[model samples]
Target chain A: MTEKGSAFLDLMGGEVFRDGSQGVKIRLTIEPHHTNPRGVMHGGVVASLLDEAAALAIKELLGLRPQDSGPHLLVEMNVSFLAAARPGDTLEAEASVLRMGRRVAFAEAQVHRGKTLIAKGRFTFVMQHD
Target chain B: MTENLSQLGIKGEAARSPFSGFIGNVLEERRPGYSRLSLKIEARHLDSSGRLHPGVLATMMDSALGAALRDVRRKDEEGIPGGTVAMDMMVLQVVREGEELVAEGRLLRRHGALAFGEAEVKKRGDGTLVACAYFVFAIGRGSPR
Candidate 1:
Protein backbone atom coordinates (compact mmCIF):
# COMPACT_ATOMS: atom_id res chain seq x y z
CA MET A 1 0.00 0.00 0.00
CA THR A 2 1.16 3.51 -0.76
CA GLU A 3 1.07 6.51 1.53
CA LYS A 4 -1.98 8.12 -0.14
CA GLY A 5 -4.01 5.12 -1.18
CA SER A 6 -6.89 3.03 0.20
CA ALA A 7 -8.92 6.03 1.40
CA PHE A 8 -11.89 5.28 -0.88
CA LEU A 9 -12.28 1.70 0.34
CA ASP A 10 -11.73 2.82 3.93
CA LEU A 11 -14.49 5.38 3.64
CA MET A 12 -16.95 3.10 1.85
CA GLY A 13 -16.46 0.37 4.44
CA GLY A 14 -17.74 -3.10 3.53
CA GLU A 15 -17.55 -6.69 4.68
CA VAL A 16 -15.93 -9.57 2.83
CA PHE A 17 -17.69 -12.96 2.92
CA ARG A 18 -15.27 -15.67 1.88
CA ASP A 19 -16.85 -18.47 -0.09
CA GLY A 20 -15.62 -21.99 -0.56
CA SER A 21 -15.70 -22.22 -4.35
CA GLN A 22 -17.72 -19.27 -5.60
CA GLY A 23 -15.01 -16.79 -4.56
CA VAL A 24 -15.92 -13.88 -2.21
CA LYS A 25 -18.79 -11.54 -1.43
CA ILE A 26 -18.34 -7.85 -0.52
CA ARG A 27 -21.21 -6.01 1.08
CA LEU A 28 -21.58 -2.32 1.88
CA THR A 29 -24.23 0.31 2.50
CA ILE A 30 -25.17 2.91 -0.09
CA GLU A 31 -24.72 6.33 1.51
CA PRO A 32 -25.66 9.87 0.45
CA HIS A 33 -22.13 10.64 -0.59
CA HIS A 34 -22.23 7.62 -2.86
CA THR A 35 -25.01 9.22 -4.90
CA ASN A 36 -24.86 11.44 -7.92
CA PRO A 37 -26.69 14.72 -8.52
CA ARG A 38 -29.74 12.57 -9.33
CA GLY A 39 -29.80 11.26 -5.76
CA VAL A 40 -29.09 7.62 -6.65
CA MET A 41 -26.16 5.34 -6.06
CA HIS A 42 -23.25 6.27 -8.31
CA GLY A 43 -22.02 3.81 -10.90
CA GLY A 44 -18.46 4.51 -9.88
CA VAL A 45 -19.21 3.14 -6.44
CA VAL A 46 -20.28 -0.10 -8.01
CA ALA A 47 -17.20 -0.21 -10.19
CA SER A 48 -14.96 0.38 -7.18
CA LEU A 49 -16.41 -2.52 -5.26
CA LEU A 50 -16.19 -4.74 -8.32
CA ASP A 51 -12.56 -3.83 -8.89
CA GLU A 52 -11.74 -4.40 -5.22
CA ALA A 53 -13.35 -7.80 -5.21
CA ALA A 54 -11.42 -8.93 -8.28
CA ALA A 55 -8.12 -7.78 -6.80
CA LEU A 56 -8.77 -9.59 -3.55
CA ALA A 57 -9.77 -12.77 -5.34
CA ILE A 58 -6.56 -12.73 -7.31
CA LYS A 59 -4.57 -12.06 -4.18
CA GLU A 60 -6.11 -15.00 -2.40
CA LEU A 61 -5.58 -17.22 -5.45
CA LEU A 62 -1.91 -16.29 -5.42
CA GLY A 63 -1.62 -16.97 -1.69
CA LEU A 64 -0.44 -13.45 -0.93
CA ARG A 65 -1.59 -11.66 2.18
CA PRO A 66 -3.49 -8.41 1.78
CA GLN A 67 -0.68 -6.22 3.11
CA ASP A 68 1.99 -8.24 1.38
CA SER A 69 0.21 -8.75 -1.94
CA GLY A 70 1.20 -5.31 -3.21
CA PRO A 71 -0.52 -3.35 -5.99
CA HIS A 72 -2.23 -4.91 -9.00
CA LEU A 73 -3.34 -2.61 -11.80
CA LEU A 74 -6.50 -3.16 -13.78
CA VAL A 75 -6.07 -4.02 -17.45
CA GLU A 76 -9.70 -4.05 -18.47
CA MET A 77 -13.26 -4.10 -17.10
CA ASN A 78 -16.73 -4.26 -18.59
CA VAL A 79 -19.78 -3.44 -16.46
CA SER A 80 -23.41 -3.56 -17.44
CA PHE A 81 -25.89 -1.68 -15.27
CA LEU A 82 -29.11 -3.62 -15.06
CA ALA A 83 -30.95 -1.63 -12.36
CA ALA A 84 -30.69 1.54 -10.35
CA ALA A 85 -30.05 1.70 -6.61
CA ARG A 86 -30.52 4.47 -4.08
CA PRO A 87 -29.20 5.49 -0.69
CA GLY A 88 -30.10 3.46 2.41
CA ASP A 89 -29.88 0.39 0.22
CA THR A 90 -27.43 -2.33 1.10
CA LEU A 91 -25.24 -3.42 -1.81
CA GLU A 92 -23.50 -6.72 -2.26
CA ALA A 93 -20.88 -7.68 -4.85
CA GLU A 94 -19.65 -11.19 -5.60
CA ALA A 95 -16.75 -12.25 -7.77
CA SER A 96 -15.83 -15.63 -9.29
CA VAL A 97 -12.41 -16.09 -10.80
CA LEU A 98 -12.48 -17.51 -14.30
CA ARG A 99 -8.78 -17.85 -15.01
CA MET A 100 -5.80 -17.03 -12.79
CA GLY A 101 -2.74 -17.06 -14.97
CA ARG A 102 0.85 -16.30 -14.05
CA ARG A 103 0.60 -12.67 -15.18
CA VAL A 104 -3.03 -11.87 -15.88
CA ALA A 105 -6.19 -12.91 -14.02
CA PHE A 106 -9.83 -12.56 -15.01
CA ALA A 107 -12.86 -12.41 -12.69
CA GLU A 108 -16.53 -11.82 -13.19
CA ALA A 109 -18.65 -10.03 -10.58
CA GLN A 110 -22.14 -8.75 -10.01
CA VAL A 111 -23.69 -6.11 -7.75
CA HIS A 112 -27.05 -6.64 -6.16
CA ARG A 113 -29.36 -4.47 -4.11
CA GLY A 114 -31.21 -6.92 -1.90
CA LYS A 115 -31.82 -9.53 -4.63
CA THR A 116 -32.25 -7.10 -7.51
CA LEU A 117 -29.19 -7.40 -9.67
CA ILE A 118 -27.99 -3.81 -10.06
CA ALA A 119 -24.96 -4.39 -12.22
CA LYS A 120 -22.63 -7.06 -13.60
CA GLY A 121 -18.89 -6.61 -14.14
CA ARG A 122 -15.97 -8.44 -15.80
CA PHE A 123 -12.52 -7.40 -14.74
CA THR A 124 -8.93 -8.22 -15.81
CA PHE A 125 -5.91 -7.38 -13.72
CA VAL A 126 -2.13 -7.41 -14.23
CA MET A 127 -0.82 -9.49 -11.35
CA GLN A 128 1.78 -7.69 -9.27
CA HIS A 129 4.92 -9.40 -8.03
CA ASP A 130 7.23 -7.53 -5.73
CA MET B 1 -26.30 32.92 -11.93
CA THR B 2 -28.04 31.80 -15.10
CA GLU B 3 -31.54 30.44 -14.69
CA ASN B 4 -31.65 27.86 -17.51
CA LEU B 5 -28.17 26.67 -16.58
CA SER B 6 -29.20 26.10 -12.98
CA GLN B 7 -31.38 23.22 -14.12
CA LEU B 8 -28.16 21.26 -14.50
CA GLY B 9 -27.37 22.08 -10.84
CA ILE B 10 -24.76 24.54 -12.00
CA LYS B 11 -24.53 27.80 -10.09
CA GLY B 12 -23.76 29.75 -13.22
CA GLU B 13 -22.17 27.76 -16.03
CA ALA B 14 -20.18 25.49 -13.79
CA ALA B 15 -21.66 22.01 -13.67
CA ARG B 16 -19.17 21.10 -10.97
CA SER B 17 -20.94 19.53 -8.02
CA PRO B 18 -20.13 17.90 -4.71
CA PHE B 19 -19.50 14.47 -6.21
CA SER B 20 -17.77 15.48 -9.45
CA GLY B 21 -16.02 18.47 -7.97
CA PHE B 22 -14.77 16.22 -5.23
CA ILE B 23 -13.51 13.88 -7.90
CA GLY B 24 -11.64 16.88 -9.36
CA ASN B 25 -13.10 16.38 -12.87
CA VAL B 26 -13.23 19.41 -15.12
CA LEU B 27 -15.02 19.80 -18.40
CA GLU B 28 -12.40 21.42 -20.58
CA GLU B 29 -14.34 21.47 -23.84
CA ARG B 30 -17.89 20.58 -24.79
CA ARG B 31 -20.08 20.63 -27.86
CA PRO B 32 -22.91 18.62 -29.31
CA GLY B 33 -21.92 14.95 -29.27
CA TYR B 34 -18.45 15.54 -27.88
CA SER B 35 -16.63 16.45 -24.66
CA ARG B 36 -13.20 16.60 -23.04
CA LEU B 37 -12.47 16.12 -19.34
CA SER B 38 -9.32 16.02 -17.24
CA LEU B 39 -8.28 15.11 -13.72
CA LYS B 40 -4.98 15.63 -11.93
CA ILE B 41 -3.64 12.41 -10.48
CA GLU B 42 -3.31 12.56 -6.72
CA ALA B 43 -2.79 10.26 -3.77
CA ARG B 44 -6.52 10.16 -3.16
CA HIS B 45 -7.03 8.86 -6.69
CA LEU B 46 -4.79 5.86 -5.98
CA ASP B 47 -5.92 2.48 -4.76
CA SER B 48 -4.59 0.31 -1.95
CA SER B 49 -1.76 -0.81 -4.23
CA GLY B 50 -0.76 2.85 -4.77
CA ARG B 51 -1.29 3.10 -8.54
CA LEU B 52 -4.15 5.18 -9.89
CA HIS B 53 -7.36 3.28 -9.27
CA PRO B 54 -9.32 1.79 -12.18
CA GLY B 55 -12.57 2.91 -10.56
CA VAL B 56 -11.52 6.53 -10.82
CA LEU B 57 -10.62 6.00 -14.49
CA ALA B 58 -13.94 4.27 -15.07
CA THR B 59 -15.80 7.09 -13.39
CA MET B 60 -13.92 9.73 -15.33
CA MET B 61 -14.45 7.98 -18.64
CA ASP B 62 -18.15 7.57 -18.01
CA SER B 63 -18.55 11.15 -16.85
CA ALA B 64 -16.73 12.53 -19.87
CA LEU B 65 -18.90 10.75 -22.40
CA GLY B 66 -22.14 11.19 -20.48
CA ALA B 67 -21.61 14.94 -20.41
CA ALA B 68 -22.15 15.11 -24.15
CA LEU B 69 -25.35 13.12 -24.31
CA ARG B 70 -27.43 16.27 -24.00
CA ASP B 71 -26.01 17.49 -27.30
CA VAL B 72 -26.64 14.26 -29.17
CA ARG B 73 -29.92 15.70 -30.31
CA ARG B 74 -31.01 19.19 -31.32
CA LYS B 75 -30.61 22.11 -28.94
CA ASP B 76 -34.41 22.36 -28.73
CA GLU B 77 -34.50 19.05 -26.88
CA GLU B 78 -33.20 20.50 -23.62
CA GLY B 79 -34.18 19.70 -20.05
CA ILE B 80 -33.39 16.01 -20.65
CA PRO B 81 -31.50 14.43 -17.74
CA GLY B 82 -29.49 11.26 -17.98
CA GLY B 83 -26.83 9.04 -16.38
CA THR B 84 -24.65 6.12 -17.34
CA VAL B 85 -26.75 3.00 -17.27
CA ALA B 86 -23.89 0.83 -18.56
CA MET B 87 -20.27 1.00 -19.60
CA ASP B 88 -17.39 -1.12 -20.92
CA MET B 89 -13.75 -0.15 -20.49
CA MET B 90 -10.21 -1.34 -21.34
CA VAL B 91 -7.20 -0.12 -19.39
CA LEU B 92 -4.26 0.22 -21.71
CA GLN B 93 -1.82 1.31 -19.01
CA VAL B 94 -1.53 2.90 -15.55
CA VAL B 95 0.02 6.01 -14.04
CA ARG B 96 0.77 7.61 -10.68
CA GLU B 97 1.60 11.03 -9.21
CA GLY B 98 2.76 13.97 -11.37
CA GLU B 99 0.55 12.80 -14.21
CA GLU B 100 -2.83 14.08 -15.37
CA LEU B 101 -5.39 12.00 -17.28
CA VAL B 102 -7.56 13.46 -20.00
CA ALA B 103 -10.75 11.77 -21.17
CA GLU B 104 -12.10 12.70 -24.59
CA GLY B 105 -15.42 11.42 -25.84
CA ARG B 106 -17.61 11.40 -28.93
CA LEU B 107 -20.97 9.90 -29.66
CA LEU B 108 -20.92 6.49 -31.31
CA ARG B 109 -24.63 5.95 -32.02
CA ARG B 110 -28.12 6.24 -30.55
CA HIS B 111 -30.62 3.59 -29.61
CA GLY B 112 -34.03 5.15 -29.06
CA ALA B 113 -33.43 7.35 -25.98
CA LEU B 114 -30.05 5.87 -25.09
CA ALA B 115 -26.85 7.33 -26.54
CA PHE B 116 -23.62 5.36 -26.93
CA GLY B 117 -20.25 7.05 -26.70
CA GLU B 118 -16.59 6.10 -26.97
CA ALA B 119 -13.81 7.72 -24.94
CA GLU B 120 -10.07 7.53 -24.45
CA VAL B 121 -8.11 8.49 -21.33
CA LYS B 122 -4.56 9.63 -21.89
CA LYS B 123 -1.82 11.40 -20.02
CA ARG B 124 -2.15 15.17 -20.39
CA GLY B 125 1.53 15.76 -21.06
CA ASP B 126 2.97 12.83 -22.99
CA GLY B 127 -0.41 11.68 -24.22
CA THR B 128 0.08 8.12 -23.07
CA LEU B 129 -3.17 6.25 -23.49
CA VAL B 130 -4.27 4.96 -20.10
CA ALA B 131 -7.69 3.56 -20.88
CA CYS B 132 -10.52 3.58 -23.39
CA ALA B 133 -14.20 3.16 -22.59
CA TYR B 134 -17.71 3.12 -24.03
CA PHE B 135 -20.76 4.42 -22.24
CA VAL B 136 -24.51 3.95 -22.54
CA PHE B 137 -26.74 6.64 -21.08
CA ALA B 138 -30.44 6.57 -20.22
CA ILE B 139 -31.91 9.97 -20.92
CA GLY B 140 -35.40 11.38 -21.10
CA ARG B 141 -37.56 14.27 -19.95
CA GLY B 142 -37.59 14.35 -16.16
CA SER B 143 -39.12 16.63 -13.58
CA PRO B 144 -37.18 19.85 -13.20
CA ARG B 145 -34.80 19.58 -10.28
Candidate 2:
Protein backbone atom coordinates (compact mmCIF):
# COMPACT_ATOMS: atom_id res chain seq x y z
CA MET A 1 0.00 0.00 0.00
CA THR A 2 1.24 3.50 -0.80
CA GLU A 3 1.53 6.21 1.83
CA LYS A 4 -1.12 8.19 -0.01
CA GLY A 5 -3.56 5.29 0.29
CA SER A 6 -2.81 4.94 3.95
CA ALA A 7 -3.25 8.65 4.44
CA PHE A 8 -6.55 8.68 2.58
CA LEU A 9 -7.74 5.68 4.59
CA ASP A 10 -6.92 7.53 7.77
CA LEU A 11 -8.68 10.63 6.54
CA MET A 12 -11.83 8.81 5.49
CA GLY A 13 -11.70 6.25 8.31
CA GLY A 14 -12.04 3.37 5.86
CA GLU A 15 -9.71 0.54 5.03
CA VAL A 16 -7.87 0.48 1.74
CA PHE A 17 -8.41 -2.61 -0.35
CA ARG A 18 -5.45 -4.46 -1.77
CA ASP A 19 -5.68 -4.45 -5.53
CA GLY A 20 -3.47 -4.08 -8.54
CA SER A 21 -3.12 -0.57 -10.11
CA GLN A 22 -4.07 0.84 -6.69
CA GLY A 23 -7.81 0.65 -7.21
CA VAL A 24 -9.49 2.06 -4.09
CA LYS A 25 -12.48 0.67 -2.23
CA ILE A 26 -13.97 2.71 0.61
CA ARG A 27 -17.14 1.87 2.50
CA LEU A 28 -19.18 4.89 3.55
CA THR A 29 -22.21 4.95 5.82
CA ILE A 30 -25.15 6.89 4.48
CA GLU A 31 -25.74 9.42 7.24
CA PRO A 32 -28.48 12.03 7.55
CA HIS A 33 -26.35 14.41 5.55
CA HIS A 34 -26.47 11.94 2.69
CA THR A 35 -30.16 11.04 2.69
CA ASN A 36 -33.12 12.45 0.80
CA PRO A 37 -36.75 13.11 1.71
CA ARG A 38 -37.61 9.61 0.50
CA GLY A 39 -35.14 8.50 3.18
CA VAL A 40 -32.82 7.13 0.52
CA MET A 41 -29.33 8.45 -0.06
CA HIS A 42 -29.24 11.55 -2.26
CA GLY A 43 -27.75 11.08 -5.70
CA GLY A 44 -25.41 14.02 -5.09
CA VAL A 45 -23.86 12.22 -2.16
CA VAL A 46 -23.10 9.28 -4.42
CA ALA A 47 -21.57 11.64 -6.96
CA SER A 48 -19.21 13.03 -4.32
CA LEU A 49 -18.08 9.57 -3.37
CA LEU A 50 -17.43 8.74 -7.02
CA ASP A 51 -15.42 11.92 -7.44
CA GLU A 52 -13.29 11.18 -4.41
CA ALA A 53 -12.69 7.65 -5.62
CA ALA A 54 -11.48 8.86 -9.01
CA ALA A 55 -9.27 11.62 -7.62
CA LEU A 56 -7.55 9.42 -5.10
CA ALA A 57 -7.01 6.63 -7.59
CA ILE A 58 -5.15 9.11 -9.76
CA LYS A 59 -3.03 10.21 -6.84
CA GLU A 60 -2.21 6.61 -6.08
CA LEU A 61 -1.29 5.89 -9.70
CA LEU A 62 1.18 8.76 -9.70
CA GLY A 63 2.95 7.49 -6.59
CA LEU A 64 2.89 8.78 -3.02
CA ARG A 65 4.62 12.11 -2.81
CA PRO A 66 4.75 14.59 0.03
CA GLN A 67 4.23 17.53 -2.28
CA ASP A 68 2.23 17.62 -5.45
CA SER A 69 4.55 18.99 -8.11
CA GLY A 70 2.11 18.15 -10.85
CA PRO A 71 -1.61 18.36 -10.26
CA HIS A 72 -4.32 16.30 -11.90
CA LEU A 73 -7.46 18.08 -12.99
CA LEU A 74 -10.71 16.56 -14.27
CA VAL A 75 -11.73 17.67 -17.72
CA GLU A 76 -15.01 15.86 -18.20
CA MET A 77 -17.28 13.10 -16.82
CA ASN A 78 -20.68 11.46 -17.36
CA VAL A 79 -22.43 9.63 -14.57
CA SER A 80 -25.61 7.55 -14.39
CA PHE A 81 -27.62 6.89 -11.24
CA LEU A 82 -29.06 3.43 -11.43
CA ALA A 83 -30.30 2.73 -7.86
CA ALA A 84 -30.94 4.44 -4.57
CA ALA A 85 -29.19 3.74 -1.27
CA ARG A 86 -30.79 4.34 2.09
CA PRO A 87 -29.36 5.83 5.26
CA GLY A 88 -27.42 3.39 7.51
CA ASP A 89 -26.48 1.34 4.47
CA THR A 90 -22.81 0.92 3.81
CA LEU A 91 -21.89 2.18 0.34
CA GLU A 92 -18.63 1.46 -1.38
CA ALA A 93 -17.03 3.33 -4.26
CA GLU A 94 -14.48 1.63 -6.47
CA ALA A 95 -12.40 3.46 -9.09
CA SER A 96 -9.86 2.43 -11.70
CA VAL A 97 -8.09 3.79 -14.74
CA LEU A 98 -9.58 2.90 -18.10
CA ARG A 99 -6.78 4.52 -20.05
CA MET A 100 -3.85 6.81 -19.26
CA GLY A 101 -2.33 8.88 -22.03
CA ARG A 102 0.42 11.45 -21.95
CA ARG A 103 -1.91 14.40 -21.49
CA VAL A 104 -5.17 12.84 -20.39
CA ALA A 105 -6.32 9.86 -18.40
CA PHE A 106 -9.66 8.07 -18.37
CA ALA A 107 -11.13 6.66 -15.18
CA GLU A 108 -14.30 4.76 -14.38
CA ALA A 109 -16.06 4.37 -11.05
CA GLN A 110 -19.03 2.51 -9.63
CA VAL A 111 -20.73 3.31 -6.33
CA HIS A 112 -22.34 0.34 -4.67
CA ARG A 113 -24.47 -0.30 -1.63
CA GLY A 114 -23.38 -3.83 -0.84
CA LYS A 115 -23.95 -5.72 -4.10
CA THR A 116 -26.30 -3.22 -5.70
CA LEU A 117 -24.88 -0.66 -8.09
CA ILE A 118 -26.13 2.80 -7.26
CA ALA A 119 -24.13 4.83 -9.77
CA LYS A 120 -21.33 4.65 -12.31
CA GLY A 121 -19.46 7.12 -14.50
CA ARG A 122 -16.47 7.90 -16.68
CA PHE A 123 -14.08 10.71 -15.84
CA THR A 124 -11.40 12.36 -18.00
CA PHE A 125 -8.55 14.14 -16.28
CA VAL A 126 -5.81 16.39 -17.57
CA MET A 127 -2.41 15.82 -16.03
CA GLN A 128 -0.47 18.98 -15.36
CA HIS A 129 3.28 18.65 -15.39
CA ASP A 130 5.61 20.76 -13.30
CA MET B 1 -44.58 20.35 -31.38
CA THR B 2 -43.26 22.04 -28.22
CA GLU B 3 -42.29 19.72 -25.41
CA ASN B 4 -40.59 20.53 -22.11
CA LEU B 5 -37.27 18.70 -21.87
CA SER B 6 -37.21 19.00 -18.08
CA GLN B 7 -40.15 16.66 -17.86
CA LEU B 8 -38.06 14.04 -19.60
CA GLY B 9 -35.11 14.44 -17.19
CA ILE B 10 -33.49 16.96 -19.51
CA LYS B 11 -33.67 19.82 -17.01
CA GLY B 12 -33.90 20.27 -13.28
CA GLU B 13 -34.98 23.20 -11.18
CA ALA B 14 -32.07 23.63 -8.68
CA ALA B 15 -31.74 19.86 -8.82
CA ARG B 16 -32.25 17.28 -11.56
CA SER B 17 -34.27 18.52 -14.46
CA PRO B 18 -37.75 18.50 -12.91
CA PHE B 19 -40.31 18.30 -15.64
CA SER B 20 -43.41 20.39 -14.95
CA GLY B 21 -46.63 20.21 -16.95
CA PHE B 22 -46.39 23.87 -17.85
CA ILE B 23 -45.77 24.46 -21.52
CA GLY B 24 -42.92 26.47 -23.02
CA ASN B 25 -40.85 27.39 -19.98
CA VAL B 26 -38.18 29.86 -21.11
CA LEU B 27 -35.45 28.25 -19.00
CA GLU B 28 -35.55 25.01 -20.99
CA GLU B 29 -35.15 26.65 -24.38
CA ARG B 30 -32.24 28.94 -23.56
CA ARG B 31 -29.83 29.63 -26.43
CA PRO B 32 -26.86 27.47 -27.25
CA GLY B 33 -23.56 29.14 -26.11
CA TYR B 34 -25.55 31.13 -23.57
CA SER B 35 -27.48 29.36 -20.83
CA ARG B 36 -28.04 30.84 -17.41
CA LEU B 37 -29.89 29.80 -14.25
CA SER B 38 -30.20 30.90 -10.61
CA LEU B 39 -31.40 28.91 -7.62
CA LYS B 40 -31.60 29.45 -3.90
CA ILE B 41 -29.95 26.57 -2.07
CA GLU B 42 -32.18 24.68 0.32
CA ALA B 43 -31.50 22.10 3.03
CA ARG B 44 -31.87 19.18 0.63
CA HIS B 45 -28.65 19.92 -1.26
CA LEU B 46 -26.02 20.09 1.44
CA ASP B 47 -23.31 17.65 2.55
CA SER B 48 -22.09 16.78 6.02
CA SER B 49 -19.74 19.76 5.84
CA GLY B 50 -22.79 21.95 5.29
CA ARG B 51 -21.48 22.79 1.83
CA LEU B 52 -23.13 22.33 -1.50
CA HIS B 53 -22.44 18.79 -2.59
CA PRO B 54 -19.99 18.51 -5.49
CA GLY B 55 -22.54 16.38 -7.26
CA VAL B 56 -24.97 19.30 -7.26
CA LEU B 57 -22.30 21.51 -8.73
CA ALA B 58 -21.56 18.88 -11.32
CA THR B 59 -25.21 18.41 -12.19
CA MET B 60 -25.88 22.15 -12.49
CA MET B 61 -22.95 22.67 -14.81
CA ASP B 62 -23.83 19.61 -16.81
CA SER B 63 -27.39 20.89 -17.28
CA ALA B 64 -26.19 24.30 -18.40
CA LEU B 65 -23.80 22.83 -20.93
CA GLY B 66 -26.37 20.36 -22.13
CA ALA B 67 -28.85 23.18 -22.62
CA ALA B 68 -26.35 25.20 -24.62
CA LEU B 69 -25.59 22.26 -26.89
CA ARG B 70 -29.25 21.49 -27.43
CA ASP B 71 -30.06 25.09 -28.32
CA VAL B 72 -27.10 25.57 -30.64
CA ARG B 73 -27.65 22.38 -32.63
CA ARG B 74 -31.40 22.58 -33.04
CA LYS B 75 -31.08 26.09 -34.45
CA ASP B 76 -29.29 24.66 -37.49
CA GLU B 77 -31.21 21.46 -38.00
CA GLU B 78 -34.08 20.92 -40.41
CA GLY B 79 -36.03 18.29 -38.46
CA ILE B 80 -37.19 17.40 -34.94
CA PRO B 81 -34.27 16.47 -32.70
CA GLY B 82 -33.29 14.89 -29.37
CA GLY B 83 -30.37 15.52 -26.95
CA THR B 84 -26.59 15.29 -26.52
CA VAL B 85 -24.34 13.18 -24.31
CA ALA B 86 -21.97 14.64 -21.69
CA MET B 87 -18.79 12.64 -22.19
CA ASP B 88 -16.67 14.06 -19.35
CA MET B 89 -16.05 17.03 -16.95
CA MET B 90 -14.34 18.35 -13.83
CA VAL B 91 -15.50 20.54 -10.91
CA LEU B 92 -12.85 23.08 -9.84
CA GLN B 93 -14.18 24.29 -6.49
CA VAL B 94 -16.54 23.46 -3.65
CA VAL B 95 -19.87 25.29 -3.59
CA ARG B 96 -21.24 26.52 -0.28
CA GLU B 97 -24.68 25.22 0.57
CA GLY B 98 -27.64 27.60 1.15
CA GLU B 99 -26.16 30.39 -0.94
CA GLU B 100 -28.14 31.38 -3.94
CA LEU B 101 -26.16 30.10 -6.90
CA VAL B 102 -25.95 31.69 -10.32
CA ALA B 103 -24.83 29.50 -13.19
CA GLU B 104 -23.76 30.54 -16.67
CA GLY B 105 -22.64 28.25 -19.48
CA ARG B 106 -21.13 29.32 -22.79
CA LEU B 107 -20.20 27.27 -25.82
CA LEU B 108 -16.46 27.73 -25.90
CA ARG B 109 -15.44 26.10 -29.16
CA ARG B 110 -16.14 22.97 -31.12
CA HIS B 111 -14.20 20.14 -32.62
CA GLY B 112 -15.80 17.92 -35.22
CA ALA B 113 -18.18 15.42 -33.56
CA LEU B 114 -17.53 17.04 -30.16
CA ALA B 115 -18.51 20.40 -28.64
CA PHE B 116 -16.73 22.09 -25.78
CA GLY B 117 -18.22 24.54 -23.31
CA GLU B 118 -17.48 26.13 -19.95
CA ALA B 119 -19.75 26.85 -16.99
CA GLU B 120 -19.13 29.32 -14.18
CA VAL B 121 -20.94 28.92 -10.84
CA LYS B 122 -21.10 31.81 -8.40
CA LYS B 123 -22.69 32.57 -5.07
CA ARG B 124 -25.66 34.89 -5.44
CA GLY B 125 -25.51 36.58 -2.06
CA ASP B 126 -21.90 37.80 -2.00
CA GLY B 127 -21.11 36.80 -5.59
CA THR B 128 -18.18 34.82 -4.32
CA LEU B 129 -17.07 32.52 -7.10
CA VAL B 130 -17.79 28.89 -6.38
CA ALA B 131 -17.13 26.09 -8.88
CA CYS B 132 -16.35 26.16 -12.59
CA ALA B 133 -16.37 23.27 -15.08
CA TYR B 134 -15.54 22.38 -18.66
CA PHE B 135 -17.56 19.80 -20.53
CA VAL B 136 -17.36 17.98 -23.84
CA PHE B 137 -20.65 16.78 -25.20
CA ALA B 138 -21.37 14.44 -28.09
CA ILE B 139 -23.86 15.96 -30.51
CA GLY B 140 -26.56 13.98 -32.24
CA ARG B 141 -29.77 14.36 -34.22
CA GLY B 142 -32.57 13.84 -31.68
CA SER B 143 -33.79 13.05 -28.13
CA PRO B 144 -31.01 11.38 -26.09
CA ARG B 145 -29.96 9.09 -28.90
The TM-scores, one per candidate, come to 0.81, 0.50
DockQ of each: 0.49, 0.14
Per-residue lDDT for A1-130 in model 1, tens only? 1111154565556666654554556777877766665566667778888887777667666675433335456888989888877778998777777987768778888888877998889988777656
- B11-41 in candidate 1: lDDT tens per residue? 2113343345456777677677777777888
Model 2 chain B is weakest, by summed lDDT over 10 consecutive residues, at: B17-26
TM-score of chain A of each: 0.82, 0.77
Interface RMSD values for all candidates: 2.6, 10.1
Top of the candidates by TM-score: 1
Kindly report which residue stretches of model 1 are placed more than 4 angstroms away from their true locations once superposed.
Answer: A1-5, A11-24, A128-130, B1-18, B73-82, B141-145
User: Could you tell me the lDDT of residue A23 within candidate 2?
Assistant: 52
